[model samples]
Target chain A: MQELMGLYTKKEVYKRFDEMNLMELLTNSLKVQMKHIHIENNQTLLSVNDNKKVYFILKGIVAAQKDDELLYFRGKNHFIGLESILFNEESELTMTSIGRVEVIEFSKAEIVEFLMGLQEGWLYCYLISKDLNHLLVRNYFNFQAKPYERSKIMLNDLAKEFGESSDEHVLLPKKFTLAILTNYLGISYVTMRKILETLRNENFIVRSDKQKEICIHTKLF
Target chain B: MQELMGLYTKKEVYKRFDEMNLMELLTNSLKVQMKHIHIENNQTLLSVNDNKKVYFILKGIVAAQKDDELLYFRGKNHFIGLESILFNEESELTMTSIGRVEVIEFSKAEIVEFLMGLQEGWLYCYLISKDLNHLLVRNYFNFQAKPYERSKIMLNDLAKEFGESSDEHVLLPKKFTLAILTNYLGISYVTMRKILETLRNENFIVRSDKQKEICIHTKLF
Candidate 1:
């Protein structure tokens, strides 16, 4: 129990889980199982037809994609695949590990049991509902805006969220290519490329050669 | 208590509320104080800046609008002013009663106490989250489609969900004006009017003089 508590504390969701009385359920139905898997660049971690499994990222980053377009990235302390289980629907997006990774998996049955047993299962549902709604709202806003406006807003929001103060750069993995950016922003590839080029020329983004990744330039902020 | 129970039973939300143990909370915290007020056509039921009070519609229909665009309509057995109370933010939309109406009101403080004391407070939050998320998702889908496509899809969905079976003509509220339809479909008025004309010419919809509202002229199913 102590070891489990320590492991959970290391994961930030533990605090929220405890507040929602999820910890007790987890303790009752929790099983800790770990597996190490090597995923080559772009290898899929989850697929549309795959059985729903909760994943805790132990190492490396995983990106969610739909039709080769990156939805978002999940890294340490973040989880994915809860949506399918909650809605009893097949996975709508694919998850691919960017590199070799280790993760712990929880089955849908276990999760359902835990949720059913919790005194505050609705809190979990509420949190998930809010997240899904926020995602939908973001998508709606992106779709309603023109390509240029969408790109500007996306970059601005990313910069605000993940940009470092010292460097004024937001570091995102190289796995998030132009295709992914276009899909996430609900824009076309050509438009995304043109916007990127324009931003780069205007000193809003700086590209690094070694990493083959781009960062928002300080002026963009 | 008897009067409150009668009102609760009349509202369909009570069924779900009871399943989640919310009825006990409401019955314990609330007393039935009936008030009669009349809303002239298109008059505001709850304005954007009005104090956050929970209102249950006893009669008539109320429509929600934001930025002068109609979003949705609520008839009997529905609660209003929840968004503001839940988020502690000002109402982003104006709610207007379509006709003369009556409603039961409870202050935010009273409602908050009722929720806080319940085991199902989290469930209430979850339900609200789900409702908001569904609305956002619908808006996203509306944005994703082209103007004409969006109108078609929305009309189809409304027909599926709310269309009534009839011998002569299928009836829907005339309140669904071009502006409201366009806003719900996330399209421009020009586009919506074009689609409506197309549907009208094709006999997919029939305008009635008696009700003077929109009705399905053809069996879409």
Candidate 2:
């Protein structure tokens, strides 16, 4: 895998609004009808066919899955169920809290009205759309890869999206478990364990003490 | 595949602007600098990493490819290279005309300015974004499917998007040749031929008389 081609969805253009002080805009928009939601560990945030609301993550991680297959993970500043609003369709992925998750929630109508009030609001929708497009492109190539390469690509994406990087390695958050990895790869627990075991023996990955979090070696990318 | 779950990206919400008379609005926005471009069959419309303009297809079809891999196809009313405008990144796919194609083109700057001028313009961007989001969701599941299932889903999607349906069959446009189908499956020519032969024997698919087009039996979906 190419380091520069690492699947980091956010680009410089996505952060363009930061210079314009998005916090102020978000603060103003907060006056609209919205809710502060707190979900317990393992709680469901959104389910397939639910399309009434959107949630912007404030803290902790959320895992998105379709049926039993894990699709991906999202963290702080990511919007959950935005696809419901964008496509005006039922939520395709079932999102759940990995740990305790905090989010600011908005009804579809409220958010749509708020977005209509701003000239640059389309840019926000455009940015989220770009994120999905990037994933599509990544997965397009990923599906064609062999098992080891597919596992490596998924881990590399996770490391880039949610890991804390150091000179030697990238440390994934504690909430990312082996079970979640297995789910993402859509393989049996035993099969995924063997794959991980092989990768570990080769020094491509390391699990921290207590097996809570995984450390991905930088050279894997 | 469930008939309702047939991968049609456009929904009732996407058609909302149609009732609002988008043509008049587009005509009004036509004052902005735009070009009418016509390209012959097999001509390149947008190359990978060249991101400057957006094209709205007025006639014929386009095939989007990443390197040598076929990503998907787009037809009339679809916009090409919009990802460049949305993400402000270099184009990821090389778009080529499948046949003699006509499109209305806009520079990145002009379209941005035009979209900013209307309050409802964000909805336009939102709709296009929704189209992409739909494709992402579709591809997410598609990547995990087996080869035959993947091929069926692609044909079903193409049937719905660009085909003319009768009571018994969905006739795809002439531009969708065997080569394109083979490219889409990412299989060797021999393998794709075998798959087609099997599907044909099973009465799931039928090639047109001239073999320039394909007809999908409605029962396949």
Lowest lDDT 10-mer window, candidate 2 chain B? B1-10
Q: Which parts of model 1 are misplaced by more than 4 Å?
A: A1-52, A57-76, A81-103, A115-121, A158-166, A197-214, A218-221, B1-51, B57-76, B81-102, B115-121, B159-165, B168-172, B200-214
lDDT (CA) per prediction: 0.58, 0.69
What TM-score goes with each of the models?
0.68, 0.79
| Candidate 1 lDDT over residue span B149-187, tens digit each | 666666766655455658755666555566566666666
Give the TM-score of chain A, superposed on the true chain A, for all candidates in the order listed: 0.69, 0.81
Q: List the residue pairs that clash in candidate 1.
A: none
lDDT of 2 by residue, A76-174 (tens): 877776554544566677888898999887776566556645645555665666676777677766665666778878878888888899998998777
Listed in order, the DockQ scores are: 0.30, 0.26
Location of the lowest summed lDDT over 10 successive residues in candidate 1 chain A: A1-10
* Interface RMSD of candidate number 2: 10.9
**Candidate 1 local lDDT, A59-100, one digit each (tens):** 667776665655555665455566433333456568887656
Cα lDDT of model 1 overall? 0.58
